[model samples]
Every structure is written in C-alpha cells, then in structure tokens.
Target: MSAWIAAAGQALLIALLAPIVTGVTRAVRARLEGRAGGRIAQPWRDIRKLLRKPPTSPEGAGVFFSAAPVVLMSTSLLIAATVPFVSTAGIAGSADLIVVVGLLLLGTVALALAGLDTGTAFGGMGSSREMTIAALVEPTLLLAVFALSTRVGTTNLGVIVAAGASDPAAVFTPASLLAFAALAIATLAETARIPVDNPSTHLELTMVHEAMILEYSGRDLALVEWASAMRLAILLGLLANLFAPWGVATGTTWTAVVIAAAVLTVKMCGLATLLAAAEVYAAKLRLFRVPELLAGSFAMALLAVLTSYILA
Candidate 1:
C-alpha cells in the first residue's frame, strides 16, 4: 500500500514538474540567445490561463476533435504511472523496455490520429510528417532497447537498472555509450526539438507537431501542451535514470529517496540545459533532411546492438 502511494505521488510529481522542465529549457535557450527569459513557472501560468477558458473548435470538426486532448493527456498520465521513477516498488507490472516504447508509440499514434481528424491541411501534413518520423525512429529505439536488454538478459527496466547498479562500470562500455547516443537523438526527434521540428515555430510549411495542434484552443490546447511537456520530462528522466542508475533508491528509505530526488533534479536540469544549448546553436533541418537524421540514429542503434553481441 505504501509503495503504491509512493508511485502515485511520483506520478503526480511528474505531471506537475514536467512544465517546469520545459520552462527551464526555454529559459536556458533565451539566456543563450542573450535575452531575458520568462520565469521558470511561466508554463504553469499559461496552463492556468488556458484552463479558465472554454475551447473553440473549428466549425466543421466533430466529436473526434473534442476527444483528442483527452486522449493525449490520458496517455501521458498512463505512461508516467507505468514508468519507474523513484523506485520500482509498487508498479503494477514489470516495467519492460519494449512495453515502455510501445506505450510511447501508442501516444504518438493517438496524437497523429487526432491531427488527421481535424481535416485541416496543416494538421494532415503534420500527421503525415509525424508518422513518417515515427516509422523511421521506432526501429532505432527498439534496437537500442534490445542492446541494453540483451546485455542484462531482461526486458524489464527495473531489472536492467538493478543489474547496472550492481555493476556500475558496465555503463562505460562502448555499446552502452552508443545506445545512449542513439536514444538521445531519438528523444530529441520524438520530442520535436530543433534540428527536427522547432517547438516554438508557427511557420506552416516547417511546423510539424505545432502545425497539428494549431487548431486546438483553450483547455484543449493546455492539455496537449502539458502532455507534451510531461512526455519530454519522462523521456529525459528515463534516459538519465536508466543509463546512469546512480543515487536512485531501491527501497523505501526516506533518506535514500530524498537523495535520489535531488540527483534526479540535477540530472534533468543538466539535460534540459544541454537541449537548450543544442537548440540555440543549431538550425532546424529541411523537411527532406529528417530521414537522414533518423537513418543515422538507426545505424548507431544497430551498431550498439552488434557491439553488445560481440562483447558478450
């Protein structure tokens, strides 16, 4: 019961702090660009303002349009609940890496469908681009998971974390390093960061994810935006905790949990800063160049898998 309570608390924390992570990234980017940024809690204010108003749907849109935000937000919450954050103590089932990947893909598909249901040209184009990226990226994501799972002989994230904890040096290996690189690239692409799709861009021709959600307004927009931020935080948390499983609690020790939380915050901040730096220094890729990015990620993931097999 206590474990379940802890899990629930962590889930809520993830939902709430997700926006802060997004804000931090934005602030870092602003600073890098030599401009003063909004407060770290700016996203919270935006969300609050959004929730106070009713959504306005396009005149011709139907029920699917109304259901889209609910689906998007719900899927993100489900994913957050399933993922092992502070501890694996009370999660309903084993946190399998494949299952995690599948949940994420499911959420992406839901968003894409929502985009298509709107019947807007930009929404359709966004959905098409999103699907194309997903199709190209999934193989790499799976391959990277396969490499790590094969090394630990389990697809369960908790088990993999435990194995790595027992042998910390294992993370320094070439295979793990390569897999991290591949996952990092996939994370950026999946999260719609710069050099992939600029999160802040409103340009119709260049916008991918933003284009799809352009029609969403008020609370619907808030839900979608919050969900995206949560997804980003969850992905970065997984990358940090899974690859570098240091300072994470294994049991219900309060002191250990506190330390773990601190470490988690620090790691997430570093990742957010790094992402901001990348976005600041890089330009968004041409639409046609996206496949090349995915292909490189796929190759690196494949190499990681091969290296793991050879090392074994």
Candidate 2:
C-alpha cells in the first residue's frame, strides 16, 4: 500500500517538476548566451495561458486528432509512474523496463499519427522525420536496455536499480558507459533537443517537432507542450537513476523517500545543466545528417550489447 502511494507521489512529483526543469534549462541557456531569459516559471505561465484559451481543431478532424494531446500526456505520466525515480518500486506488473520502452514508442507513434491526421505538408514532413528517427532510435534504446539488463538477469526497472544501488561501481564498466552514450543520444533525439532537433525553433523549414504541433492551439497546445517537458524529465530521470542509482531509495519509507527525492533533484539538475551547455555550444544538424548521427548511436549500442555478452 505504501509502495503504491509512493509511486503515485513520485509520478505526481515528476509531472509537477517537469516544466520547471525545462524552464531551468531555458534560463541556463539564455544566460550562457548573454541574454536575460524568461523566468523559471515561464513554462508554467505558458501552459496556463494556453489552457485558458479555447482549443481549435482543423476542419474534418477525427477523434485521434483531438485526442492526441491527451494520449501523449497520459503516456508520459504512465512512464513516470512505472520508472524508478525516487524509489525502485511502482505499481505491480508495470515496472518492467520493456514496458517503459513500449510506452515511449507508443507516445512517439501517437504524435506521428496526429501529425499525419492533419494532412498538412508540414505535418506530413514532421511525421515522416519523426517516424524515421523513431525507427533508428528505438532499436538502439532496446539494445541499451539489454546491455544493462543482461548483467542483472532481469528486465524489471526496480531490480535493475536495486542491482545498481547495491554495486554503484558496476555502472562504470565499458558496457554501461557505451549504453549511457547511446541512451543520451536517444534522449536528445526523443526530447527534440539539439544536433537532432531544436525544441526552441519555430522555423518550419528546419523544425521537426514544432512543425507537427503547428496546428495545435489553446488547451491542446498546452497539453502537448506540457507532455514534451514531462517526457524530457522522465528520460533524464531514468538516465540519472538507472546509470547511477546510488542515491535513490530502495525502500518506501518517508525518510528514505524524502532523501531520494532530494538526491534525484540534484542529479536531474546536473544532467539538465550539462545538456543545456551542450546545446548552447552545438549547432543543430541538417535533417539529412540526423540519420547518420542516429546510426552511429545505434552502432555504439550494438557494441554495448556485445560487450555485455562477452563480459558475462
């Protein structure tokens, strides 16, 4: 009972803090570029303003077009609920890493469908690019999971984290390092960040993600934006806890949970700051070049898998 409550609380916490983490990244990037950026509350303000406006849909839109934002947001929440963020435990049967990977792909597919449903050129283009990237990233993501899971003999996220927590030094091995690199690239691509895609750009010619949401307005746009932030938070949290599960709480006690939450915050902030710094210095790759980068990441993940097998 307590574990379930803790899992719920962790999900709610991720949902709430997700936007703030995004805002922090924006602010840090702005400062690095010598501009006084929007406040840390900017994302929240944007969401609230969008929600207050009336939602608009395209002519001849179907149920999927209208429900896409809800599906994206719900899937992000579902992923958060199942992953080991503050604690290693979640609702029974949903805590498996394979299930988490499936949920991530589901969110991607849902967005791609919504993009295609609009029937606009930009929508079609974005959907094509997103699906292309998904095809390349998903396999690497699964292989990275396989790299880590092979060592522990379980695909359950809780067990993986428990194993890492018990032996933190084991996470520094060649296989884990390669998997981390692959996962980091996938995270950047999945979250629509730089070198693969730029989240801040609205230029349709160069934009991949923003192009898809071009037709969304008001509350629908709010949900999509919020979901994007949540997805970024969830992925970064997983990278932090799974690769370095040292500070996460294995038990569901209040004291342990509190400490776990604090440590997770620091870890997340560190990763977000590092990512922002990277984005500030790096330029977005041409759309044609994205596949090359993803292919390289896939190769790295394949190597990680082989390394894990040989080491075992």
Candidate 3:
C-alpha cells in the first residue's frame, strides 16, 4: 500500500513538475540570449490556456491523429510512475531498462503515425526524419544503459540505482563515466533539444517535432506539449538518479521520501538549466549532419560496453 501511494504520488508530482521544467529551460535560454524571458510558470499558463480551447483535426485526419496524443501522454505517465525519480523503495524495484526504453519508443512511433496521418508534405517529411533519428538513437540509449547494468548483472533500473547507491565507488569507473557521456548525448537528441531539433522553432524546413504537431490545436496540443515536457523532465531525473542516487529513499519512510523528492526536483531543474545554457552556445545541426552526431554517441556507447567488459 505504501509502495502504491509512492508510485501515484511520483506520477502526480512529475505531471505537475513537467511544465516548470520546460519553463526553466526556456527562461534560462532566453536570459542567456539577452532577452527577458517569460516567468517560470509560463508553460503552466500556456498549457492551461490551450486546455480551454477546442482541438480541430485536419480535414483528412483519422483515428491515428486523434489517438496519438493520448498514447504519448499515457506512455509518458507510465514511465514517469515506474522510474525511480524520488523514492527507490517503491515502484523503482520493477523498473526495467528495456521496458522504459520500449515505452519511450512507443510514444515516438505513435507521434510519427499521427504525423503521417496528417498527409501533409512536411508531416511526412518530419516523420521520416524523426524515424531516422530514432533508429540511430534507440540503439545508443539501450547500449549506454546496458553499460551501467553490466556491473549489477541485471537491466532492472531499480537494482542498478540501488546497487550504485550502496556502493558509490562503482559509479565513477571508466565504464560508468563513458556510459554517462553516451546517455547524456542520447538524452539531448531524444528530447529534441539543441543540436537535435529545436522545440521553439517553427520554420518548416528545420522542424522535426514541430512539423508533426503543426496541425494540432487546443486540448490535443496541450496534451502533446505537456507530455513532451514530462519526457524531458523524466529523462533528466533518470540521468541524475541513475548516476547519483544518493538522496533517493531506499525505505518507505515519509521523511526519506520527502527529502528525496526535494533532491529530485533540484536535480531536474539543474540539469534543465545546464542544458539550456549549453544550447545558448550551440546551434541546431543541419538535417544531414544530425545523423553524424547520433552516430558518434552510438560509438561512445559501444566503447562503454567494451570498457565494462574489460574492467569487469
């Protein structure tokens, strides 16, 4: 019963925190660019306004278009609930790496299908680009995490984090450091951040994610945007906890859980701020060159796996 409550609380917390995460990144980026940015609560305001409007589907849009938002939002929520964001004592015990990766991929595919359903030239183009990137990204994400899992002999996320927490020394090895770099790059690409796809860009030529949602409005847009924010937050939280699970509660104690929750929030916001600062110094890569960036990350992941074997 305690575990169930913890899981539910984490999910609800993440859902609420998602917009703030996005807003933080945007605000940081804007400030870095010498512009006064919107408030940290701006994303929340945008989502609320969007929610109050009615969505209009493209003339030929069908079930896929209508279903994609729900599917993406559902998978994001499930991942948020299952991953050990705050308390490792709860649902984190069952958080498998493969399952989390699969859920992430499902959301990606559902959005791609929705993009195709629109039948617009840019929609299909964006879907193609997204799938191409996903092909390169998915492998790197799996292999990078696998590098960390090798030490513990299991791909269970909770076990991996718990093991690292119990033995902090193991988290700083050559394999672990290499895996962290690989996963960080994968996260940037996976979240459609700088040097991958710009969330703020609407230019049809450079848009990958934005193009897919060009046809959506109102409630549908709110869900998609909200889910995207949640995903970014979740990945950052996972990255922070996987390598630095120091504050995560290992027992179902309210005090420990509360402390862990506070730690998780700080980590997520810190990561988002750092990412935004990095983006200020970076530019989006040309479409053709994006694959090269992803390929390099994949190579890093491969090396991490090799290093793990050699060291182990």
* lDDT, each prediction: 0.83, 0.87, 0.90
For residue 221, model 1's alpha carbon misses the true position, in angstroms, by 0.8
The number of residue pairs in model 3 that clash at the backbone is 0
| Best candidate, TM-score | 3
All-Cα superposition RMSD per candidate: 1.5, 1.4, 1.0
What is the TM-score (0 to 1) of candidate 3?
Answer: 0.98
Q: Which stretches of candidate 2 lie over 4 Å from their true place?
A: 90-94, 169-172
Instruction: List the candidates ranked by lDDT, beginning with the highest.
Output: 3, 2, 1
How would you encode candidate 2's per-residue C-alpha lDDT over 234-276 as one tens digit per residue? 9899899879888888778889888988898888878998999
Candidate 1 deviant stretches above 4 angstroms? 170-172
Q: How many clashes in each candidate? A: 0, 0, 0
TM-scores, all models, native as reference:
0.96, 0.97, 0.98
In candidate 1, the residue pairs with backbone N, CA or C atoms under 3 Å apart (3 or more residues apart, or in different chains) clash, namely none
Candidate 2, poorest ten consecutive residues by summed lDDT = 89-98
Model 2: how far residue 166 lies from native, Å: 0.5
Pairs with steric clashes in candidate 3: none
How does candidate 2 fare on TM-score? 0.97
Give one digit per residue, the lDDT tens place, for model 3 in 200-263.
Answer: 9889899998988899999999999999999999889989988888888887688888888898
